[model samples]
Target: MKRKDQMIGSAFLCALLCLLMAVSGCQSMEDQNYTVPAAEKSETVNLKFFGNKNEALNVVAIEEILKAYMEEYPDVNITYESVKGADYFDVLMKRIRSGNGDDIFMINHDTMLELMKTGELADLSGLPTIEDFSPGARSQMTFDGVVPFVPTSISAFGLYCNLGLLAENNLEVPETYAEFLAACEVFSEKDITPIVANNDISLKTLAISRGMFEVYKGGGAEKALEQMNADPSLLAEAMRPGFEMVHLFIDRGYVDAGRTLKTEKTKDDLADFATGSYPFMLTGAWASPRVAALNPGLNYKVYPYPAQEDGSVLVTNVDTRVAVNARSAHVEEAKKFLEYLTQKDVMWEFVDSQSSFSPLEDNRLSSDPAVQPLNAYMTNGRSILGTDSNLKYPIWDLSKESVRGLLKGQSVEEVLGDFEAGLKKSQPGGAQ
Candidate 1:
């Protein structure tokens, strides 16, 4: 009996030991090697942005964007330095050449090629957001398969009217060439200059509207633009109507050629328009805020320049572009800012505040009353990008100069001939 009892005790002890061993093994397994993820360390970064929005209102608009960006990225500090007028380009080029370029800067389609020659702008072609850009804007920003900048907003050019003056004059916004002439006559009868522009101005704005109207008259805006690109000289014939339209304005006494030739741009034109000295002015939507800032009580609106056939033609193109410097120490940070700017909410807000349009697949324009008149025109496909045709090439300079010569009393044939000559000279191996 004692032996049996001892044997039972020994069996009980073995079971307890097995249970303890199992528990200890489980504990050891729990304590085995494992890795804990390290927290991401976001380093503080500083970036410098150079832009040409010098007007007070535009400066404020830009500041709003920067403020929002900073809020989202507390560790990133960005400073914007505004460069203004014609001198801005030269100054920026000098800074870039000297290795002192800003981390990010603004560029334009017209100057993109020239700027690229310096080999300073970075290639952003690999960015995923690039696919979101408008076809025309993307083409303009790209060169030889390299994209140097991300277009921020699609810049549009049109006529700005003082609504109060139009109402007082009992004139409806002109839709036809004849209606436009009649309205101008009415304004002239009241002893008001119907149109005013800077000394550097010619019917270039009108020509752009007319040129686009002629090109798009047959329905395929894109196809027609491609043909013009294949052979840029085609623009000479297409753009002739624009010159004639300008001549009509001058001949009808609707505009005083001499005074227009004397008025200074930006300063004089904005002052004239703000003071209600003129009924209409040829300008861009980007300048609308500046006009308002000068005289907040003045009511104004922008519309496409009247076309002979539809009277709803608009000259719309990408204007301000932002790019990063290839040599920037903060390239990744600059790219992050660009990506942040591409967010739909962020992009549309900037476009609306600037009185501009979006270049994204989900395109949108400013909702401001001053810019609403253009909404219908844009939706109806009555607008053309300024980059369409030879305008994207060096031929643009000759085109502007030809318009100036026409304003100076040069014959249409002479001006057109000059353009042809200049176009050939600008081409490789065609110089004479």
Candidate 2:
């Protein structure tokens, strides 16, 4: 990472540290300062996770889980090569290809395809019962015909509205694209600025622009997949709206693009939301625990991303995947471990225990109240959705670059043109 990006990350951590200290429930599943648990003596099991979850919190919780696992297995010596979310994939991929990926590894949705190609993932079929798991996670674990890992946790992006802010403003949460834009208008005129977004292709905005387009191109996921596989340019036209929306958000002031360089960090949003410096956040479920923990008494709710088309609301599940490396020396054991993690009993426990949503049709694991509204929205069956298939290898290598450039003032058409060119260059069989 560049020095500037590193500095931004540091500032983000600093802000989060201050907010977590002051907020009531900011402690992650475990405190980073805690000691490792003493489990039953077991063989040294070496496994590594490349996840970028709450870095500090995940470290302890993950260690604890391994401790419990070791208690049962009693012969596992787990070696972790964990990296914080900061430049996680960049570091993880290098380690993995060099024959150093953990016994098991965690990856973002974006890199799953390339990782799968290295034949490093283990097939998790019949290893665990996932019929009760969320389809989104199940599908993500499998690329093409190969099922690699188990679904552990899900991350969702939606509205983080401050009920108090709305009540004071005499406003109801917007239900359509127009209402949403209107709400922003009201907030901006009130000099409230109304939103605290990082503005640089991060969560909320990234979903609205890229991920949403991936899903909203609607009724065409399969086709889009084929198109990208054959000739990426064939799908460029469908991507125009995604590019336009990024520009739209900035032009309409839904996001202050001018401040993007300084605020493109999650910590910035967390700080503003906690201090009531901003009342609305266009983020994901990852922020839910923070809201609940920080202001137990505050009134807040999550809403589906508003859409321009009536009844055209779409959701793109972009995170939550676990995969095994086909080349792993302990592929069999890794398979069993991942299967255990996805068992209905285990998956639900993981979801509830961690305060998250499961894509499983099983109603047993309840949702975080903030995003419960999705149940009704999803139940209505009016939603057309898709997963973050962009992680499907070198095909999408240009994804972030194309989007980042578009957001940084390049033309949508030009970005797509360049993206198609890059896609052709990177295709295994070569573009048609």
Candidate 3:
């Protein structure tokens, strides 16, 4: 009897010991025999991050976010490097080619497709918490269901209507192209330079072209992307109507050709709109807050670019995305880092800090100032479509040259024809 009791006690003690250890292990990821990658197995985790320009993207936010991550995985060492938004592409390319690109990097929506095609980006197939992402948003983050990146948030492109300027002229929101023009005319006549755009040629071109193209094609960014990837031969007449609307704006003498030639920054246009009191500025939602700050209770309401097809067409932009180089020496660590960043807690805090809108679905939509209006756009009566959603790469890229030539002297048809030809040459078995 004594022996049996002792045996039973030993078994109970062992089981209890295991249960206690299991509970402890579950409590802290930090109390481990090894830091992630088991420092015993790997020598070191050298990571670098590249970010775009934004107030919340400043050093303080980056540091705090990374520090939180480090606390969870003590063995990792990360470095933060950034460039001005305008000069970022240049520096990023240089670093990437020199084998020093950050482990995690920011990518443009337009570039994501091209990058994925080249297979230089890591396949984030099983990223943590991706199941929590916004539904359609996944289309932007993936190339054919193969997750290539993790986006922090989504952005939007809309009209930053200067309500005060509109009120001064007794203008209500313009309901049609003609009304839009009339409102501009009033501002122009008053020497307010009705519609101001950033001097950056690309932005001006996209702002003017994106709206018209979407209205013309009757689709969003993804459909247009498919056409671009499919055939360059079919783009001419399809794109003609859109280009015509753009020319119509210039023909009215409302948009200043000379002004665009002299402009290199949106600041020129934004400053003019904010301080110069220009009646309209075609820009992203980010501009909405800045203008509000410039003139408190400015009575401004953000509007989507008026549809040329005379329908509701909203230009949606995806927020910055996190992509790892497939070629990176430390791909495992990099992939783990990307997955960690996508966690609901991590992403929410990042977006909260920036006050930028996020599409993460796990958490409730934000109610804060910066993100509030954007969140409303999702629920409000306004229709939303991805900006480059259906844009054919050729049509999208062609806008640059077409705008330059049309702005200079080329007839709209001639410029569009040239644009089509360029696309044809890029397609296989076409006239390269």
Candidate 4:
């Protein structure tokens, strides 16, 4: 009886041991196949972008780029908003001041200057893409050796010539200021309008082209700019040569100041030039597409402004520069997006969609045929920044007003004096 009971107990113990081993194996198998719950995975980061370009093409292009970025980085989400017309700056300032600005925003050179004063821009020196930009573009976006913004596109201001009209008159495109004047003289003698002038941008670009070559070129620009910034009155002397050119245009009947003052830019002037009667139109390369669409058969080409004695100079402005907000909650993510955006292929895609030149060093020449003539000037370093942000006063506005005075029959000295007086009044605690 005792032997039989021992056998039974041993058998029971073996069975219990076997059951424990089987349970352990099952737990091991479950552990091997376990996965983290979807809810506990990495959190998604959200970003917002604001821009001033609300055109259909701009909206579509940016949206497509953002979509591609999101697909590449599945953990990120971006929202884009844009304001149109002149009210964009005001709205942007209000949002920033209210501490509710977007993570990334588009700014012009003037807005960049204003933002720098308030420490609103993030330091983008760490970005590798900064080195990929053209030297001129990088320099324009740099302040005290620190880059705060990334330029996306560069807009060139040039003389839009009616190629058919020039061919009809047996004249070639002008290459120098002297040749430009000579062409204008011939057109005037033939009772044809030399240029279609307007109150906006026409004189401003002309003065910039002439003044940049005559006064701002070489190494003398720094001291002169400093002195002019200190006392705005000095700008008259610095700008006198260009102003004289404006005066001469009026005096020679090359442009009718009275009619020009009444003409609307990009509307009246653009229409008149499309008629193929005027030989020249002083405008930005941005207008080239519109000219083509307006008069598809009109043979035209945009050439660099004929400002130099030996050759022409291209007046360029870095447009639609993207800046990261210093106060953004997702700063790292924002910067990463900028890095993606400025990649050669992505940057070219955006710039080409806008019909502007890429700011990249390796891709300065535009694919657009109408603006191709200005590419040589850009390649040879004959380009100058039309909108210089370092100036203390609003140079564009001042130029417009000064040119307006000239068109209204005010002498160059009188216009300069008026400009000085206006500056003094705008100073702190000066006049209302």
Question: By lDDT, who's the top model here?
Answer: 4
Q: After superposing candidate 2 on the true structure, give the runs of residues whose Cα lies further than 4 Å from its correct spot.
A: 1-43, 55-64, 79-81, 130-140, 199-220, 311-314, 361-367, 382-399, 429-432
* Candidate 2: Cα lDDT at 271: 65
TM, every model: 0.80, 0.77, 0.77, 0.80
Order candidates by lDDT, high to low: 4, 1, 3, 2
Q: List the residue pairs that clash in candidate 4.
A: none
Residues 99-146, candidate 2: write the lDDT tens digits.
877667776555676676667777777664756665645655556776
| 268-310: candidate 3 lDDT, tens digit per residue | 6555666745666666565554565566655566665664436
**lDDT tens readout by residue for model 4, 1-432:** 999999999999999998998987755565676677999888999999999766565678899999999999999999999986446778998999999989999987667766887899999999988899887677677775678889889888889999999999899999998999999999999888698887877877788788766555664666777777778777666677778889998989889788898877556777888988899988778767667778999999999888667888888888788999999999999999999999999888778766689888787467779988887776676777777655555566677899999998989888878767766665445587
> Candidate 3: misplaced stretches above 4 Å?
1-44, 54-60, 201-228, 262-266, 293-297, 309-311, 352-355, 362-397, 425-432
Could you give candidate 1's per-residue lDDT for residues 1-432 as a string of tens digits? 999999999999999998998987654657777665555655679999998877766677678888999998999999999866655777888888888999999876545766676677888887778888877667666676788888778777777888888999788888777777788889888877798766543367677677657666656666765666556678677878877877777776677777777666677788888997678888777778778889999988888877676566777767678889989999988988998887777778677777888888787768767878888776686777655422445544565687777668888888888877776665445666
lDDT of 2 at 381: 48
Off by over 4 Å in 1: 1-45, 71-75, 97-99, 134-141, 199-202, 218-227, 262-264, 389-392, 429-432
Error of 1 at 33 (Å): 15
Q: After superposition, how far is residue 384 of candidate 4 from its true place, in Å?
A: 1.8
Candidate 3: which pairs clash?
198-266, 220-389, 220-390, 221-388, 221-389, 221-390, 222-389, 222-390, 224-390
> In model 4, which range of ten residues has the least summed lDDT?
421-430
Worst 10 residues of 3 by lDDT: 202-211
Give the C-alpha lDDT of model 4: 0.82
Give candidate 2's error at residue 47 in angstroms: 3.0
The whole-model lDDT of each prediction reads 0.76, 0.61, 0.63, 0.82
